[model samples]
Target chain A: MAKNEIKYLTAIKADKRVKKFCRFKKYKIRYIDYKDVEFLKKFLNEQGKLLPRRLSGNSLKFQRKVSDAVKKARQMSLLPYVTDLLK
Target chain B: MQLLQDLKLLIIILLKMELSAITGFLLAITNNQKSFKNDPLSLGLNSYLCRPKSVFADSFRTMRNVHWDKPPSQMLWRINRILNLPAIAFAKAGLKQKGKMNNYELMVIFTPVLSDDEFKAEQKKYAKLITDAGGSIVAENPWGLKSLAYPIQKKTTGLYWVLQYTAASDFNEKLKIQLLRDEAALRHLCTKLDKYAVEYNARKKSGAKTGTEKLAEV
Candidate 1:
């Protein structure tokens, strides 16, 4: 039974897909800027909320930068906090 | 062997307790719920949560049907002030220096009611103001009659003008006072540009499409 459990665990681990690449790194973006609203929108959901790193597949540092940029964009009125019903 | 097993179990239990404690602490900090509750000024959270379901439903229904015919009554000036607090603080700290020439980008939204002649005159007046202050206008783009995201001073649309210039550090104070005194100017934002920003704007103006041009194309 233990042998079967170990085999199953190894199989699960082997089948799990790892996200080792970051979008910002791939694009060679040095800083996540608020002015780039189009680029920033990719990191947001339909509700205008910042997606979690797990879902967005962003590195920890890049995610922090993106969130900060999004907040600044919101403050500047470059982006909306919520999508109004009237669109 | 039993004693060793017991020791291992105890260590595991302690580790589990510590992990849980750390997770709770992290959750508290990340959610910011405790801070929101503690803050006296935050009407958003408590009001949103404690409001009656009927009231919530009514607002949601109204929100869906609402049109832009009537401007939103709440000006939210306090919210605007709060949002601009960091910029204001930075300006206060940086404004002590007097004769340093710096690049600045200014966007002024004029009341849309102005006639074409008055608009031209107003533009000339500001252009003269920059020259009189010993500053040179690098680029000027007049983005005429664009709909605002939200109405300002009950005006649905505004005549947007963007000016990039190099001026003395002290010139911004005078410019701000003038803008504030002008009733025709609905809204204005002045941002000091760094070396990189100046280069980017120059490049953009020379060949690349300006933001308004891109919008126009769309």
Candidate 2:
């Protein structure tokens, strides 16, 4: 019974992750271009902060790609360093 | 994860609605539901709104423990996002905007020492070049002299000019060569405008409030 319960718990964990699939993999996107500021905003919060990899469900490789792109976009002024939307 | 994001968005919308608050609707609640307990219309908001306890101390909990009597259903939220509905979902979320032209947005930083006449003449030269190349200029905005975030060629500031035009797919290479040959421009970038960027540019041109959300590019 103990073994069965552990198996059941793992099932639930898998079920939880099923919904959080990595979008880059789904879209088959080979490159995450920083020029697409509009797309990069998905990885940022309203306050212009980068969302965590876990929350966004980004794979490790793609998450690094996103961070690099976001930083580049920020430098290019295509995206903002800080957004004062609240003010 | 999307549910959490949506709940946070709902709370934010509710927070904003408080400004012209008339009637109270069923609002989703975060754990620290103290502020809105009473007549939230009067805005008894304090710590809980900006700085909730636990996990965080200086901001709203965002998506944590947001419970409401009549919460937006998960399926409905997903559908709403897919449809790219306004207010929350960040203007259509993941879905691509429909009917976008193949347009490119170009930004060039010219040496700041150029006189106004020189700048206009140079701008006209590019405009004519674009027209001659079977492309049409959609919009032009001269940002004037602006300081850069860092020094380029030891200069602290440069004249910024922006242009949006639709061109052939392979035309970018030709344009790049032209820009590379032009010594007057300190820096330049040409990006194909996606549907969202197109929508954003149109909205901004309409003089809407959303334009202020992005900061002035330094």
Candidate 3:
């Protein structure tokens, strides 16, 4: 929790990558927390474009499962098809 | 008195004619039978002469008239006939490779009576069988212990598990036979999913953002 502690964000250069990729993809990162519903809503707003499997460094099998879970969440209205502009 | 009687009789006749007209109209719409725009008198006479036949008879006739001996018109009627023909032939084929049929979906309901470890063992066993049977498991999740919607063998609470898989027809037939023999599976139902349902579901899952980016909160 210390200011100078080595963070996961530092390890992945997460913020730098987010900024760099968002600009390239023309996506607006509503939030950086991937598990956050707000971040998912922002992702859905861009339509079907999902996180690159390599960037997540996840196994392809696990990535596929995750992708499918996300879709099921969206259809159930747990994730919105569009971002709430005010949020 | 005779005048009054005649008026009553006229009213009854009119009511009967109106009923016949309404019946004919409904019959035409439902059966896609060409409408008989004839007066009630004619319609009623036809009904009287030949016990009212459903206009569905027309479609039934078209189904039967497809002669293998002659060239089909290759038009809408032929198309309609072709579509209608499959259900009978498919039904006769008897669920062989039914799981492989396009749009087929299997809903496997698992109710395990064993402890968690035993259940996991059973899950692994069935999961392998499902894959080996040429069905791809699509969605699986625990519904937890719950009561059945209705009493099956006088049991109330059951451990609920659901599996959605797509399989080929013969695979399904084989799976169904296996399930019948398997003791762990309490009840199972297989229903074909519609094309639109599958497409909509796939689109909904294409991109989802959910995973812990940081260490556990606690």
Point to the candidate with the largest DockQ: 3
Off by over 4 Å in 3: A1-87, B1-104, B203-218
TM, every model = 0.50, 0.44, 0.33
**Each model's Cα RMSD:** 26.8, 25.4, 18.0
lDDT of candidate 1 over B99-177, digit per residue (tens)? 4589988878899999999988988998899999899999998878877655678877889788899998889899999
TM-score for candidate 1: 0.50
Candidate 1 lDDT over residue span A1-87, tens digit each: 475544343434446676556766665444554556776777788778888988877789889988987886665455677774322
Candidates 1 and 2 compared by DockQ, better number = 1
Selected candidate, larger lDDT, 1 vs 3: 1
**How high is the lDDT of residue A32 in model 2?**
64
Kindly list the per-residue Cα lDDT of model 3 for residues A1-87, writing each as its tens digit: 677866464455435543222221222211232223453443332443456754544455544644654564443333444444423
What is candidate 1's fraction of native contacts?
Answer: 0.00
What are the DockQ scores of the candidates, in order? 0.02, 0.01, 0.04
Q: Indicate the worst ten consecutive residues by lDDT in candidate 3 chain B.
A: B209-218
Q: What does the lDDT read for residue A32 in candidate 3? A: 31
